[model samples]
Target: MNRVILIGHLARDPEMRYTPNGTAVTTFTLAVNRPKTKEGVEQQPDWINCVVWQKTAENCANFLRKGSKALVEGRIQTRSFDDKEGNKRYVTEVVGENVHFLSPKNQGNLFDEPFSPRPPVNINDDDLPF
Candidate 1:
């Protein structure tokens, strides 16, 4: 079983795209920080690539933005392909099965709206522009 669960901050807004068959897909990099290192210096953030499909992808693209914190559950997959320079490249990505919105900014907003499965009408994709 290949499984992965990550809780991290978005390094950038999710890049949303559609498959040839009109399946929605979104990709984003997460910056995961290590708690503490033996050296006591901050360890470099780990950049994990994650992809979500269908409604999950749409939700991610609609709500997620750079610096947003989220929890993702998925499986790890590594694929090898040739680069433009003809060099073999091994790319590792998480095929996300679940994405949970954990944005801090949304907490205790002026309206005091509670978190919902779907964001409010006012918080639709157009408002986010992510």
Candidate 2:
């Protein structure tokens, strides 16, 4: 299975656009920090390109902004295209299946109220086959 999970901060505000078919698509760059070396020096963050589709794209565009923390779960995809200069350019990006906003509700353009976790369900001991 081709899958990836990334937790990072948005490098900039998400860019939202509509396709000719009116599908919403949003693109953003995630700044993921690299692990520290043995010398304990700080490493430059990896700027990863990510794409979100449909209503999720709209949500991302509306709520996320520069410096917002988020978790992205999706598959990595790579494609190539010819640029205006006639040079072939390759791009690797994560096509987000789910994007969770991790920043505090008070941060950026998030919802007014903080999100609460759902209550856990109670299960009987007999429900287990083992």
User: What root-mean-square deviation over C-alphas does model 1 reach?
Assistant: 8.3
The C-alpha stretches of model 1 lying farther than 4 A from their native spots are 38-40, 105-130
Q: TM-score for each prediction? A: 0.76, 0.82
Candidate 2 ranges with C-alpha deviation above 4 Å:
109-130
- How many residue pairs clash (N, CA or C atoms closer than 3 angstroms) in each of the candidate models, in the order given? 0, 0
- Residue lDDT tens for model 1, 1-130: 8988999999988999999999999999999987777878888889999999999999888888888888999999889999999999999999999988887546421222366365455556767757
Q: For model 2, which pairs clash? A: none
Shift of residue 105 alpha carbon in model 2, Å: 1.4
RMSD of 2: 8.7
